[model samples]
Target: MGISVEDEHGDEVDRIVAAWHLERPDLDTAPMSVLSRVTRLARRLDLERRAAFADQHLEPWQFDVLSSLRRAGEPYALTPGALMNELMVSSGTTTNRIDRLEREGLVVRSPSPEDRRTVLVTLTAAGRTRVDTALIALLECETRLLSPLTPEESHRLAGLLRALLLPFERPRTAGPPRG
Candidate 1:
């Protein structure tokens, strides 16, 4: 069966529009195809996520960086390179973010005993508390958003998403783009 409006949901339309322009020369495809809708819905989900984080006084990028370390367990720390990779940003950008988080007293830098040249970025007590609170609020917001869906449906959707992500989980060589 073709993808339905209910299945697509959110901002699927905009994503389709963007893709159509990019691949139109190669194929005559409708903008509202599967990938397009998924892109648009992702955009919409991002906006909602930002608003949810905003309610906790956290920027989306801030939450991303903070949460990554928080999920690291124990001391809640990682090297700057780790943060850069997780945030998918340039080294300079990650440095800037660390600087800002440091100023806000959310994170701190300490010398790595094994490698004096490397520094570990650890979440401060305050940072951990902030992320903990933000996480609770964020989960509550998500639960409410998905309230309309039955429990079985939610579980099924999550399984479907996991299945889709499985193929991309393994490491792969970098190469030229494929159509």
Candidate 2:
């Protein structure tokens, strides 16, 4: 016996495509059928993330910066430039976030011993606790979102998403490479 398309379930995206096909027969909406679902899923995930972080009295940006430091292992610090690169934000924005977090006692900035001119952002004990708690909530929220998929299905979906994202993850070089 072989599986058939009928065995697959149609989602909201399928209905959307059907309507678009009826209304605009000339335009090919095949790409929308997949990308739309991804976009919608991202929106839902963002809401879930907001709720999860809120439960821990933390904002998404705070979690992002703190988690970056937390993941940096012992000492749990990084230069402001490193943080700016990691967060993909402007230097001013990074400085503001670090200042806010510092005011909240979540992190502190100390002059780097190796170079007094350079400042390092270190996560405080409070920041670690908050980030760790927020992470648990985040995982719980994500697990609920993925509950519809079996383990195998989840792995397959993750692999597909990774394949889609890989091209964007590569660093872009300026101009042609020197011989």
Candidate 3:
């Protein structure tokens, strides 16, 4: 873990691949050279995210939901169904989260003016402050995580990752709000 990935002598991934090569000489472990580092980096990023949220007393899902609402701007509101879709969670989970957030005074649930049958979940001032603080912290941590890479390297990495992941993802959609 202490080894730098850029070291010409090699890093932790090299050590792991060498061990696999020793034990299973016939199999090609070429993919591990790239993917193993990505896996380790993801674990580290998860830790960073948790640490960022810790000071704000936020769970990851809380940050996700609050951030989603914050991004909507203005009234900072969205329907429970919109939230469920955005968060990729079940209807029940969305309701439970909104209920807890309402109880905490971080958000409010009210009947939508646009539709009587639907409920709107709006972020309270407290929620905005909390989510904004958490966002700044998370970005700071993430910046440090990528400190080893130059901006050009980061951009290239992001593009490569997008290409790698696109096939496994749902088809790209225009991300505007829809009625």
Which candidate's TM-score is highest? 2
In model 2, residue pairs whose N, Cα or C atoms come closer than 3 Å (at least 3 residues apart or on different chains), thus clashing, are none
Backbone clashes under 3 angstroms, per model:
3, 0, 0
Model 3 residue 75 CA deviation in Å = 1.6
- Using TM-score as the measure, name the better of candidate 2 and candidate 3: 2
List, residue by residue over 1-179, the lDDT tens digit for candidate 1.
23333445535554445455465646656634555656766787788888888867898889889999999998899999999987889999999999999999999999987898999999999999888888887888789878989999999988987876666654566543343
How do the predictions measure up, each by TM-score? 0.76, 0.88, 0.84
- Candidate 1: the clashing residue pairs are 11-40, 12-37, 16-36
lDDT of each: 0.81, 0.89, 0.89
Model 3 misplacement above 4 A:
1-9, 172-179
How well is each residue in 1-179 modelled by candidate 3, as lDDT tens digits? 33343456887898888777777879988899899999998988888899999999998889999999999998999999999999989999999998988888899988989887888899999999999999999999989988999999999999999987766565457453333
In terms of lDDT, the poorest run of 10 residues in model 1 is: 1-10
Compared with the true structure, the alpha-carbon lDDT of candidate 3 equals: 0.89
What TM-score does model 2 achieve against the real structure? 0.88
